[model samples]
Target chain A: MTTRVLVAKVGLDGHDRGIKVVARILRDAGMEVVYTGLFQTPEMVAVAAIQEDVDVVGLSMLSGAHLTLAPLVVAALRERGSDIPVVVGGIVPGNDVEDLTAAGVAAIFGPGASAEEIVTAITTLVPQGH
Target chain B: MTDNPYKTWREAFDAAPTRDADFTTLSGIPLEPVYGPEEGEFPGAYPYTRGIHASMYRSKLWTMRMFAGFGTAVDTNARFREIIAAGGTGLSTAFDMPTLLGLDSDDPMSLGEVGRCGVAIDSLADVRDLFAGIDLSRITTSMTINSPAAVMLALFVAQAEERGVKRSALGGTLQNDILKEYQAQKEFVFPPRQSMRLVRDTMAFTAAEMPKWNSISVSGYHIREAGSTAAEELAFTLANGFAYVELAREAGLTIDDVAPRLSFFFNAHIDFFEEIAKYRAARRVWATWTRGHYGAEDPRSWQLRFHTQTAGVSLTAQQPEVNIARTAIEALAGVLGGTQSLHTNSMDEAIALPTARAARIALRTQQVLAYETNVAHVADPLGGSWFVEELTSEVERQAEEILAEILDKGRGSMLEGCIAGIEENWFQGRIADSAYALEKTFNAGRRIVVGVNAFTEGNEEEDLAILRITNADEKKQVERLAAVRQARHAARVEAALATLKRQAADPTINLMPALIDAAKAEATVGEMMGAMVTVFGRHVEVPSL
Candidate 1:
């Protein structure tokens, strides 16, 4: 099966250039990328990820709310009996990377993460059985 | 023709003393020792193709308004003082995303976002704390708030009242441009027409009451940051400005009375010559439109004064320190283009909120340009350059074409046209398309980003320490909001909000007085904006891309 990824913008941050670019990148990389538009709450994202049945979910946040909001998205998926890992990206500080990983975020892509690296990370998140 | 007055000067320049050094650039393109045809309209004249002022920086340096706000009121207040003490001329406040969207700190939507991107302002109490020690009367402050900018302005006026500062004595700007919100920033709350009402109300209020305050910093900074070309940034900003002028005319304000106080905000992107050309074209377009189209009599009304912020999008995540060089080059472009004020992005802006040390260096970048370098001695110093003049005219032509397209959509009403465009994702579609194309170019290695593509020699690990604003600030901000709510008289707040809602529904009444009354009652930004929301429903964007 082809890799499926759910891309979303959680919370009130509206810097969508990176997310939009990454969405196109994933699509170009031969992956089915479902993008849930802006102002999505964690619950909405989790529900969308589950409904889409994607292999991984990507959250783009630049409002410095990643630490508080990203983990909640991860937990929201688990609460819904879904283990769909959420990948995070944006202006994330270096120190918070580990905390985000420990919170079950599959991967973190900072500002300069190349298209190849992002595609690889999403690809690796896909299970072979899928 | 007429002996070509420049012939003598050209011949003298050709026979001028030649240096032994090669005039060719590193790329091997030969450069003329001197450029000719250095004749054009002077600065401070009609059309303002050169600088808006005759002397430009020779008379007064561009105000350095460093945008620094994060965490609680007290936290941001300290940073404000640091900026002030560091010789920053003006204060520019950056509200948190929640604050920008007009949500209370305790609102569920504002969770994890309070004081994150900027300061968390809830009520007048928070504003009081935010500007506690800062002199409201003497210092000019620019608040980067929109969607709920009228509410923010009301809160500002109420705070100024508390400080016993006369409303007319106030000097500052409100980023009250809402058209770009739908087009780019996406920080909008109410629908377009309703938001225009709020903007018109604020413009009318400032026109009548505050002489020094710029009612709207009609902005293209966010538009360019959202990946618009420099020309698009100029044209969109000017078109929106013209829209506001139309709205003001309908609101019974004279063009001259309102136009002089209407300033602009633009982005100085990394396309150095192109960015400079964009500014020159912007002034020419705005001046021509205000005079020829709007029939403004005052020269100040024709002059376009703008604040330039170095493009934040151009900063790189790889070899973050390299951003300083980019910022310096960009700032030089802004200065050369005759910006009225400037904000240099910090080296670590791509990673996080600027560290104090990093912000100081950014400020120093401006200081170096102003004091150390002699770039400011002449106004519109690059005006006569053959290349610059050509680029300016070309950018203006492109911008004017798009602007005309938008104008036709509203039957010449920019406000209506903007609303129509927002309804159908016209601006959004174009912006998204441009962004996608640029990303493709970068991805395909067609363009070179120093650290990201061409020269990737930096460490994988980012070692630069960044300023962190944790949820502790959120907790404190929420607690403060709660305390403000508890302390203020609830009945007064409700009554003021009711009046505000009543006034919002009425087309004849200006909403600023009611908004100011609500602010006086200690009504929160959410409550005031909530009242407007009740009158004008929320905006659900037409999803483009």
Candidate 2:
């Protein structure tokens, strides 16, 4: 079984280092990755995920706009009838991680997360057959 | 061999191998056992392992450039005055996102972003207002805008002209680095090739007219903040700088003609020694490349003068005040590393655009360092330190290897296809791995960041007032943009824009004159950018990973 992930940057956050790094790690780990460049709208991210048929959508946002952007991407994905899991990593505050989780984010990786852990999380969150 | 005084060095060391936990780089380069003169050379020489100039910060302190912008032009003008009044020696302008993206405030695309991040400038009128009472002759200003940098440059030139300031008398920097916008910032309007053309035009124009002005500030601040490793930041930025120099040369400007005006902007990350080494290595590499590779004879052309910004990524939202400490440490590294100018990040940066109070504190960080601290009393204070010199040499060596790898692929080929390839392979991948590794370390309790995964107690809600631009301010900005558009003569704007479009399509013609004409004719940023975008289509990054 192969894993496909769409790594995206949403909103005005121009920081792509985390997302770009994650995308590369996932690819090297034998998963297909799609990198959505900076300033992506939630709708664009969800559409890209659906069109690419990715297994999971990972969001990397450092800008304070994550409060508005993260939830919108999740909601947009669900509304588009894609039940793919979502993962987020960045400078998100500790208190807000739970908020992101409650918004249907499968997992939240903060500043200190490793690529192996993220790959493991995605592989575990979505079963092979699913 | 076993009976040697060191007990066969490895054998004796192996018996204990006292793992010096304190001696490792963020990238895991181990500290050497010892260093002699042969290990790394002296300061102010090739490889610049120690320092760029013989007397560094002791000769002149780093330029105290506070990043200032907010609300209307008048409001931001007042803030600039406040920063200057508060002992800032240089000025750095932060334009609102709309201006940065070449959109007028009234544009539908600019909704909710006008005057939020920085100041809003619609035309030369706004530029005039921005520098209304400010003297351009005495103090230098750095503008941090890229895509519409040529337009802003025109506006600036016109503003200075209005004040009877000769182009020759003007001094400052324009962050005319559009390539980074594509690679990191995403504020780019035209595609890469056309953006390079605009940069070439600006370089040619400034070289001829405004000799005192730094045409392009080749920036690695955004690249580092975007998550590049220190080595990646150093190599990629120099590569981009080399590309710009090549562009200027292709535009018929001599290497010496433009190299002196080329400045750099770097991010001073939390890795204190590593960041310091990065700066030293940067100057050495830039100087070497300018003199040896580009054959630049002028000493001024060989020097790498940069402005430093404390790493915004190092700041955490949990304990925002802790950022002040982080910024101070980073700023110190920059100062010791010998930056020409510096902009310290605000403590509240992780949460919002810095409030006035936060901005003041940020500025004061530099002030205290400049006056109160004895750190600036001597030049390149750490120039001869064994540890610093060793680290600087190691960084330069590693960075040179990376540069070789980048160039081995052929500079032109790399510029053509390797950019996307590298974005896929090394650039984005390495960033991901580092970010992931750091996260894993935190989660596993190996790495501890205060107020984060570990030492996570005593986090409390504090009553803090954040300065926010109201919807009313946004409304006023939009109205102002609309009024500027309405007031400008329609036919003149059209004709000027048409001329710009025609000139933009030609490789031989410099677009700066046409852009200046358009700016003077009161064509708003979006109108000019939109016109050029028509000639040069919008860039869409093709995802390779």
Candidate with maximal lDDT: 1
Task: Give the Å error, residue B380, model 2.
Answer: 2.0
Segments in model 1 whose C-alpha atoms lie over 4 Å from true places = B1-39
Q: Write the per-residue lDDT of candidate 1 for residues B307-358, one digit (tens) a residue.
A: 9999999999788899999999999999999999999999989988898999
Q: What TM-score goes with each of the models? A: 0.93, 0.83
Task: Give the per-residue Cα lDDT of candidate 1 at B57.
Answer: 64
DockQ for every prediction shown: 0.69, 0.23
Steric overlap count per candidate:
0, 13
Model 2 per-residue lDDT tens digits across residues B1-545: 43432233334234433321333434556543322333344344444544455444544567888888878898899988888887788888988877887878877555556776788888877888888787766678999999899999988887777677787788989999976777566677777787878888899999999878899999989877766778878987887788788778788888888888899999999999999989988988988887888888987777888899999888776667888999999999998887889999898777567877888899899888876666654446666687887888888888788777767665443354335534344554554555656655655678667776565565466724565665578788778877887888989989999999898788889888898888878888888899999988987665533
Deviation of model 1 at B187, angstroms: 0.5
Evaluated at residue B503, the lDDT of candidate 1 is 87
